[model samples]
Target: MMNLISNAFLVVRPLEKRNKLIDEYNLIIEGLRSKGINIIELTSKEHLLSTKYLCSGHWISSLGKGVVVVYPMSSLGRQQERNDLVFDLLGRKGFKINDVVDFTEAENEGFFLEGTGSIVLDRLNCVAYVSVSKCSDEELFVEFCEELEFTPVIFRSSYSDGLEVLHTSRILTVTESFSIVASCMVKDKKERKMLSLQLKKSGRDLIYISEQQVENYVTDIKQVKNDKGDSFVVMSKSIFDSLYTDQKNTLGKHGEFLVFDCREIERQGKHSIGSILNDIFS
Candidate 1:
C-alpha cells in the first residue's frame, strides 16, 4: 500500500527552539520506519503558516499505486516545504513519476485544497469524501477530482470545539472492509447518509464515533498490516484511552491496537502519527 507523508518541515514558533521538536519528529519517523512503510519527504524550502498546506505531500505521491499529482499550497511557508531533493530521492527509489500538476500559484492566490487532510480517499472505491472548510476549496476540490478521476462527495463537518474540520482524515478512516467516522462531526444528515451509503455500496462496514472521542483525536487512527498480514490500528495513547469499551472492541475485531504516547508532539499541534511517518513507496 502507498502511504503519503511530508518531511519534518515546520516554522518554529517565534519563541520556541526547534531542535527538540526536530528530534521528536525523528523519533516518530523512526517508529514509522520500524513498521516497514516507505517514507516520501517533501523538502520544499518555502515557508507558509498553515498546517493545511503540509497536506500537499499527499498529492506528491500515488494513493495506492504509482500515479503522482501535485497540489498547489496556499500557505507561503508550505510552498517552501516542497523539496526537489525529496522527489529525486523517491524517483531513485523506483516510484514512477507519471505527471506533476502545479497549483502553487492558484493556492498562493487563495484557491485551496488540503490534500488527504481535506479529502478522505477511499482508494479501493475511487471516492473522495471532503468537508468544506477554509482549507478545502469546493471548485479546486472538484478540479482535483476531475484531474485524478476520483468521485468527490462534499459536506460540512465541525469538531466538538467548533473548529472547522481541517482534515477529513481526522474524523474518518477507511480500512479494507470497514470505515470509522465520527458521525457527530458531520452535521448534515443527508450528507452523512450519502457518505454512509457510498461506503456500504463499496463494501465497507460503517463504525461511528462520537464528538467527545474525536476531540481527543481518537478518530485520527491509521490501520496498517504487518508482514504477516496481521492488521493493527496505530494511534496515540491519548486516543486509545478515549475510546469506549465498545469502540475498542469494534476496532479490535478488525486489528490489534498499537498506541504510542504523543503528549509532547501533540503540544506542537503540527504532528500527527500519520504525518510523521514516511510513505515507503516514496
Candidate 2:
C-alpha cells in the first residue's frame, strides 16, 4: 500500500534562536528542500520567552483531505489560543478547520490532545492509536474518535522516570508498511499485546526499538515522497545512528532514507525532525 502523501509542511518560525538553533533549523529546511517538499513557514508574533517548544506541527492535526483539527494544547504556554495564528495561516492556504471537538471548552474542562504528537493515525484505515498521557486524555480521545469516525486504540506508555511520554509520536509511528514502536515503554502485558494485535490486524509489520533508541528520538521520523514521486523517509542523524543495520536494511526496502543533523533543535525541547514537519497534502 502507498503511504500518505506528504509533499508540504506548515512550520512556524521561532521569534528568537541562538546560532546553533539556526544551524539546526537550516539543516532541516535544506534537507526537505533537497527532497522537493514545500515548506510553509510563518513567523510567530507572540513571544514565548521561556518555552522552547514552538513547533507548529504539535498543535495542528490534519484529519483528512481539506480538513484539519486545531487542538487545545496541554502546555500552559502553548494554550490560550496560541494556535490560532498557525490555523489562520493554514486557512489562508485553503484548509477548512474542523469543529468536531469543542476546543474552546476542552482545555477549561482539563482535556488536551496535542494533535499528531499525542496520537498516531493510520489514515488509510481510519484508526487512531493513542497513548494515555498527561497530554492525552482518554475521555476526550473517545469523544474525538466518535465524532471523527476514527477507531481509537487506547494504550499507556511512559519514560524511565515513570512519567508519561510527552507525545505518543515520540515512541510510535504508524506507516503503510511497518510501524516503529518502543514496546518496552508499555509496561502492561495485555495492553502491549493488544497494541501489537491491532497493528497486525491493520496489516502492518511491527518494528520494535529499544527504549534507548526511543530516547535518541528514533521513532520521531516522517515518511514522504520527493518531488519526482519517489518515497523518502526523513529523520535525524541521531535516529540513523541508533538503528541497527538490520533495521535500516528492512526500512530501505520501503523508502530512501534522508538524514539531517538536528541535534541542536532536539536538545532544546526534544523537538526534532517529525515534530516540526506538519504534512499538508494536496
Candidate 3:
C-alpha cells in the first residue's frame, strides 16, 4: 500500500519534435529521478511510426509484480513492430514481462484498450473505472478486469455532439485518498451517480472538476511515493496553474505537488504529464 513505483518508461519523442521538447523531457526525467524513480528511456529505430503521444501511460498498464498488459492502438500503424522494439528494450533492461493479453491478437480482432488511459484504476480498492470509447472495447475491458480480479465499473462518457472521450485518464484521476473526476463529461445521471457513490464507498473524497478544467488537463494527475515513503502528486505546470486555490488545498492534503513544464509536450502530443509517465510496478 506504499504506492511507490520503482521504475517508469518514457519514450524519446521523434527527432524533429525533440528539439523543442528535450529540455522539458529532461526536466521531467530529473524530477522523477529526484523522487527515487528509475527512468527507462525508450529510443527506437522506428521512431517515425511512434505516435506523438506514444510515451504516455495509455500504451501500457502494469499489474504489479512485473506483470503488464499492453493495448493495441486503433489507428496507429506498425504497432506490433513498435511494441516488439519496446518489449525488447524492456527485456534488455531486465524486465521479465508476462503480457496478460497479446496486443497483436487484440489488434487482429480490431479491439483496442489503450492501457491505463482507457481505465482509471483504484488499485488499492481493487476497482477500475472505465468509460467506453473507441480506445476501450467493453468486452476486452471486462475480460482484462476479470484476469486481474478487478471489479470493472463500466460507464459511458461522451460530449453533446456524441464525440466520445478518447481516454478515461483524461477525465478521471484516482489517487490513494481521493479522486479528481469530471463528472460533467458523463452525461448519464445514473452512471454519474454510480461513479460518485463508488468513489465515496472506497473512502475517497471526490473533487469534481468542470468540463473546462478537464480541457485544461486537470484530471491528468497521479500520486506516487518515494523510497522514504514521501508521497508526491505529479502533474503538468499547466494543470497545476489551472487549479483553483481550493482545489490545490484539497489535493495538498494528500501529497506535495511535483510540477514540471510540459506545455510543449502537451501541445505537440495532446497529452499531459500523467500520460507521459507510465508507472513501472516491477
Candidate with top TM-score is 2
The digit string of per-residue lDDT tens for model 1 on 94-167 reads 66666566655667568776565667777776788888877778888888889777899888888667778876
Residues 1-282, candidate 2: write the lDDT tens digits.
213666568776654546677667877787778778778787765556434454665666665555666676885777642555666776787656654344536888788888778778887788888999878888877877887888999999988888888788878998767789888899899989998888878776678898899988888777777678877788888889989999898788778898999887688767677777777754
Residue 224 shift from truth in candidate 2, angstroms? 1.0
What are the models' TM-scores? 0.81, 0.91, 0.89
User: What's the true lDDT of residue 218 in model 2?
Assistant: 83
Window of ten residues with lowest summed lDDT in model 1:
6-15
TM-score of 3: 0.89
How far is 89's C-alpha from truth in model 1 (Å)?
1.2
lDDT per residue (tens digit) for residues 77-97 in model 3: 535324446667677777778
